[model samples]
Target: MPLMRPRMATARLTPSRRPHPVTAAGAKPAAASTMGGTLRALSLLAVLAAAILATGCSTAQIEQLKHSRTGIASGERVVILARQHHSTHEAELDFVECVGNALSRGANGLEIASHSDFVNGLYPWFEPAIAPLNPEELPALLARPGVAERLAETGVRYVVWMDGMTERVDGGGSLSCAAGPGGAGCFGLAWWETDARYEAAVWDLKHVDQAGLISADVTGRSVIPAVIVPLPFISRPQANACRGLAQQLQEFLVVEDQLTR
Candidate 1:
């Protein structure tokens, strides 16, 4: 198989920024209580409205990679790997697992290799400390006779490297909580937004070159308001990101539609 140069592209969703009001000190207890109550009511209304409006909105975005035709065939064996640096996050592992499961179930009929199995079987040949190889490093690593034999024995043709993280980008508002003899209570309003960004690089081991790169970004906001009662709104940014990345991987690998003989 002839080596194919990798193609890369990026897509981003820019969040609209709004200035947050600075909390001021020396506010009277009565005035503060009144203001907090009013803000809580308004925040509750805003959360409800936003939830309804956001039902029709999607937070995921994908930038497709352009590359020459990969000689990959349907039902090919593929392994999904999370960068060693990214392996620290449980969410990252979950994302990779989602992608692998989706690929296995997609029309492409790809055989998704288990990450644990791949790591264990490949063993010292592909050290974990050195694993999650970048595109440039893959060719040389795969070119080694022992590594090549191990990969062949494992029947893995393509390797997908996933790296990135989701983080809280912006936050505002404040919520206070207290416990009384009667019960516990939380008051005021609080909210935060998160952005999930990840990139998948496809390496064709047979060709000893990178196939392409797929990038997905998902941003979502969650709001919580307390009006004697705490109302929590969840954004589910990680879930959205997982779905988007999985779908893009299916399309990028041309596995979305079944191949007809």
Candidate 2:
């Protein structure tokens, strides 16, 4: 997604068409006035940033398909993995992290193993060049010496292989800003649309079979209308997708009959 892109330079307002020559006393006030103007401009930018973060609209839908029975017992944990080896469809790091965090929150949240530590423990096996892309490859991977033992130590019940990314699908509108000696202001309006489509395959390591598939699709439109200060009504589909996916993933793994503290 494109972030707020604005290039602004420090500018100040001077005495309006002064007919008299500038004196030392007058020069001091102009300098002070310039400093005050810069501070105000900075304050406005801070407000804009807050506005952009606080105001956004997003739509999300989630689907879950169970391939086989799936649930996690007590003391078991889950690991979130992404398809970094893929060329164009690889999931981004931020989305992966966001999902992991979301899954680990709330009172009934699931346990999550440390992603960095788990990957490091497997080392070369989980590396991009050698990583197993799907559950079918797991048997061969475990047959490798030391791979099964190392994986067993993590007590991971499922491995979620995340695939997909957020894309800028469509956009329109124009916005422009200019700065000069008189001060600076922005005008015009710009808008863009982004779609986040992500799907994760839950691999049941304990059973060495596929558990279920969860998919999240979200669409959003972000707009910036600049009259004086650019007011951004940013839409974040990625965040919404992450949240929805994580919730569904949690529900998919926890059985109501078997709740563990």
Candidate 3:
């Protein structure tokens, strides 16, 4: 028999195996869990957006009454002063300044006298002890010696007396914090509402009459949500009240057509 050639050993391979589904019966629970987590994240984001929208906002209701027609000439001056005679709290200095600056701005704005300077210039007369509380008391104050002459010399034509203050009228929320050996932190949410009430009486020194009366009531909501540090969402009720009152006041003094009766 012919010599048989040495047979070489060789490894054999079957056909390639197809990829199996990753989320099969054994992994289906994990896939569902991942989807659930994503949905929860989206819902939390929406709630936060809504909360931000609801906080740090202010609203105002303004009213005006015309006692008599009023207008100011270029040479005339108006001064804003806070009334101390009111039984309730008096208007804040910043609020008074805000209104005065607003009225003195713009091309159509009126000439505004310095609050401190005007009060000081008419010192002793406009002292807190004897300052006129309303337009009716103006005549008596003006009748004092040298008062009339001093006012005329300064070209002071109008007087705006403001009274009121801001208060925290309502709030409802709870917050708690705790400390541990591992760490110290604060966690919780709180909210509060503020109300700002302000009113101004306009008097005409030249005519010795009440020109107009304007008042503003503003309410605002603020919230603070904390995880580790408190995040305050402050609403500016006083500032909003001042801006609204000033805009209405400027229009009130311009003497357009007739006036709001």
The CA lDDT of each predicted structure is 0.66, 0.74, 0.72
Clashing pairs in 2: none
Candidate 3, position 112, lDDT: 87
* Model 1: residues with Cα > 4 Å off, grouped in runs: 1-47, 50-58, 71-75, 85-91, 178-185, 255-261
lDDT of 2 at 258: 24
lDDT of 2 by residue, 22-80 (tens): 33234335434654676755654554444344334445667766666567788989999
Which candidate's lDDT is highest? 2
Candidate ranking under lDDT, highest first, comes to 2, 3, 1
The alpha-carbon deviation from the true structure for residue 251 of candidate 3, after best TM-score superposition, in angstroms, is: 0.9
TM-score of 1: 0.71
Q: TM-scores, in order shown?
A: 0.71, 0.73, 0.76
> CA shift at 42, candidate 3, in angstroms?
4.5
Where does candidate 2 stray beyond 4 Å?
Answer: 1-57, 180-183, 256-261
lDDT of 1: 0.66
- Predicted model with the maximum TM-score: 3
Q: After superposition, how far is residue 108 of candidate 1 from its true place, in Å?
A: 3.7
TM-score, cand. 2: 0.73
